[model samples]
Target chain A: MKPKRTGKPEAAAVDRDHALHLLRAMTRIRRLEEKCAELYSAMKIRGFLHLYDGQEAVAVGVMQALTPEDAVVATYREHAHALIRGVSAGSILAEMYGKQEGCSRGRGGSMHLFDQETRFYGGNAIVGGGLPIAVGLALADKMQGRVRVTCCFFGEGAVAEGEFHESLNLAVLWQVPVLFVCENNLYAMGTALEFEHAVTDIARKAACYDLPSTAVDGMDVLAVETAAARAVAAVRAGEGPQFLECRTYRFRAHSMYDAELYRSKDEVRQWKKRGPIATFTQKMKRRGRLADADVKAIEGEVAREIEGAVAFAEACTWEPVEDATRFVYSEGRMP
Target chain B: MIDGEQALRTITYREAVREALREALQKDERVFLMGEDVGRYGGCFAVSKGLLEAFGPERIRDTPLSESGFVGAGIGAALGGMRPIVEVMTVNFSLLCADQIINNAAVYLYMSGGQFNVPLVIRLATGGGRQLAAQHSRSLEGWYAHIPGIKILSPATVEDARGMLWTALQDPDPVLIFENSGLYNMEATLGADAGPVDIHQARVRRAGRDISIITYSASLYKALEAAETLAKEGIEAEVIDLRTLRPLDERTFLESVARTHRALIVDEGWRSGGISAEIASRIMEGAFYELDAPVARLCSQEAPMPYAKHMEDAVLPQAAGIVDLVRHMVNAHG
Candidate 1:
């Protein structure tokens, strides 16, 4: 089934400050991703670069529901999640540039970003690999009697993996506080949802594990935030695990190298029309909660941040060849 | 088997492992045991029997047959500051969760640039003495030792079975402990005060000068028995038990080879690309000049383990084979 087009945010409940915060977050991701594409073309940023172009609202909205103490496990396409989770743009860009100053100290590149302080487990590249880690994190919290939630972000494609089903069953059976967020972007790289899953509704599959689940309009930032807030609250209250299936789409190709033959340009154009940034911005304008000057100011601030990040990445130094085998085991503890 | 002054008691290898588990759980509140039938039903090998009633369900977790899920959970739990001892029923079953072990547990610290350390310990029953057939019986310690970042250990004696768990739990990286299925019921005397032992050295079980018989796990006993039979013929064979597989202690074995001028490796794993091959290669590299003869290896035949008793015996490395090989090597060189 085609994703239902999200309606406008409620005008009466719209707060100007909150609307701008969401818009700024989405804009920052868009500008950074656009810069990454340009860098790839110029041969500066190498390796697999997965851009989170149309799924900005999902990351921004879900992040709003999380606290500093809670943990996050994200997918390979997680530059936006890393940014919104407070990983500095300079470090992230430097990491993609393979510099020692990167968050993972150049060991992990674009597909494996990690930040210990922010509790960002990693930019796990394996499909369905992060699900069990997330479940275990929540299991640790529950066993220790700590009141913390672990939010895991993955694509709807992960639903087809055995780890997804295993993790869901384990979480519910153990009653751990995990918020499983499925970004059902209508495609698993190039395969659409219909071809990948017999039961197309991702939330329904989660509910089979007796997990509390809901589907939200992913393009509408406010709708996603509301649903995520409710889910995160239930999880924190020890009501067991919760699942949120965000009906979303991605406008760009799966990775840097793509023939674009698996999908048509018209399909991409249709999704771009309802892009997360554009739809959210227009809704705020129509509600009179945002002005054109505010939009331009946000754009200006995001542009400078992206430029500074690029400069930092360009000036960063590569890790020395002698220390290439470092971190294979913890320093000073190598066998 | 009793010491000069210290108190001593005899226990089965299974009980020794149980004592290790009990000691770890009692010492640290952060330590918990999770696996299939580890709690209420006891362990599949009955190694964790009575732990459920002693520690309660919270600490002795009985998980579903989701190996990848629970093993990955153990890694995450370790990342979250809990020491988890995950048990995969057998080496064969461990293949189900090999992705989690190889991809996540072994690579987390490096992939994350040392930002995360998985202090996780995984214990699985290995080797094939029982007629459980091909699917249930395997000796894959050699395959696991090939990977970096993780530590591979094969504890053959009651002392090692009781002591290795505590040391493995203290490691910052992942540690895999391989318990041979045949040794679970073997009984040996242990010092009442016996606690932790070093995990980085190879111990010489018996000393001699004619030849060096290097082995570990169940094969260590076979080597010892062969040494006894060779002593009657005046062919003194030194026995070396490789307690640790990875980061192998080449010094002890090299010194032995330097004195004896011959080396014989016995392993239950298949001959092709097995731990014996690795040890043989190491001997060539480190003790080539000291050796008077070519290094020899007696490993399991390159075939799946069979169900018939005689066929299985023929496929594995036995005491007769070790004696025959050692006698031939000593006589040819002498």
Candidate 2:
């Protein structure tokens, strides 16, 4: 096959396997979310379904830089992060289905996915809520002499919250190892970033705390990976926290309930033209790193995985109503 | 346990709390106290005075005036496998950190499918007095007690002030200890050997049969004083200090009410939706038939705390108020 041109300057250096892996991960997220939207329409997956249809590159790219030992604190729109961080797609689907076998025992549905084995702290529903928790986790790691990083993920809207500023200050002052990833998708559930923040340049906000920061093309998986690798490295080296602003766009509504009245179709169409999966796949195929056949194979595999996950979720049992109050306190510790 | 050979030292409630913090820091490497002015400023109320020198800055950490930030960090630290004691200056200011305390710290364990338990101890000065006014003197422990995943402690006495911190640190859940702002200077003998006390039950401060005066925190003193005054009048009153408020040692208070047949709840918080209402509800539920008179509650007036000393005293449940209420209850029933 004749090798085509690499349209983007940053896509030229991409390797075959790495490109394929990134493509597979993003494809997996896209398929899973497509299935989730289906389930929500069918009245299966209830509550808020913040699909990561257009923001897959950020989670996939960032997860590549983290180790299994490290901790992750993500926001409600975190299915992609949880999946890329080695939480089973089955469990993620189960959690969305509100099954007892779900990651959080079905107690926390779509927005509260928690996996202790993987150290995925939560699916924090509140904006900017996980930032301080990430700081404390990093503080614990520093105090315990562990050289691990705690990555906190939030939206650009979170920059306006008091906890965000407070967390950044604490992380910088205490020299805790934390990577604050702000996925700026332009809108925070109908509120545009311009409307929400006085300083829309999210990285500059972190800079006010004297923390090193970088803003990257969140649509390009390679760009996000490179920036996150550098930030995570500096944090793990004990240079203190780093802020990452992933400038991306979400093609779908903020939630299933959103009307998209805040933005126009021309704006959505413009962003969807530069969608992460299509752009990344085309770049890979043009560079001869991935072929059309490889893309088809990856899609088939993801389809089977999503189908199996849906089956697992459908078969999962419900927690008895009698045990509703069992976990309010630690039953194992207190008599 | 109190030892005979060891001498009992009389210390203020502030000193006892500081001693407990010191003991926790020394006993466990994971235990640390972080709050505003706790280190360099020696605590807002001087409860952690000299702890910075004793435990150094890392363990006796002083945070900026970001209650939500530090308190949420405390929850995170606890989840990260460290026992952190977060001190908010007062319950009034705790509203700033209420989201972290009520939403994150109190709900994480249950919401996380019981996989993550926040072994955090949050100690805040609560209750009214000293003319700090509305912003500084609100008794909001009742608000925290309404939360599920966290335990509530009101350490009214010196022994509890010294002992409850260690026990709260041991529990594999979040515990909030409310130290009344009024009790910091109150002095009593604390056994040198005083250590971790049971944080699961209420303790009877005085024994009587005429009426049961149930209370916690600083109001325990008022109930005790009322019991003494009633004793002199030949109308004996029992005083129950509810050390643990959330799990509520209902058995102890219910048994006391069963014997006394009349109950009076003295709380520094407001009457409606306060801890007094909860105690009254429990009594009505468990000891409904064991009542000679209605289970009365003496609480602060339903209004924002005033700055004037006399007005503040009039609003709160004072010793005189408890005495007057108990005398009225006994007289009406007799």
| Candidate whose DockQ is highest | 2
* CA RMSD per model (angstroms): 2.2, 3.7
TM-scores of the candidates are 0.97, 0.97
lDDT of 1 at A12: 57
True contacts kept of 1: 0.74
Worst 10-residue lDDT window, candidate 2 chain B: B1-10
Model 2 superposed RMSD (Cα): 3.7
lDDT for each residue of candidate 1 in B1-334, tens digit (9 for 90 to 100): 4455458889999999999999999999999999999988899989999999999998899999999999999998998889999999998989989989998999989988889989999999999878877887799999999998889999999999999999999888999999998999999999888888889999999999989999999999999999999999999999999999986888989999999999999999988989899999999999999887889999998889999999999999999999999888888877
Clashing pairs in 1: none
Tens digits of lDDT, candidate 2, A1-335: 11111123367777998898999999999998999999999999999999999999999999999999999999999888899998888999898888999999999988999999989999998888899999999999999999999999999888899999999899888999999999999998899988888878887777777888888889988889888888899988888888888999999999999989999999999999999999999988888999999999999999999999999999999999998997899986863
The residue-by-residue lDDT of candidate 2 on B268-295, one tens digit each, is: 8888888888899999999999999999
- Predicted model with the maximum lDDT: 1
Taking the tens digit of each residue's C-alpha lDDT, what string does model 1 give over A1-335? Answer: 13222344464586999989989999999998999899889888899999999999999999999999999999999899999999988999999989988988988888889999999999988899899999999999999999999999999989999899999999999999999999999989889889999999888888888888888889878889988888999999989999999998888889998666788899889988999889888988998999999999999999999999999988999989998778877878633
Q: Model 2, residue B197: what's the lDDT?
A: 88
lDDT of each: 0.91, 0.90
True contacts kept of each: 0.74, 0.76
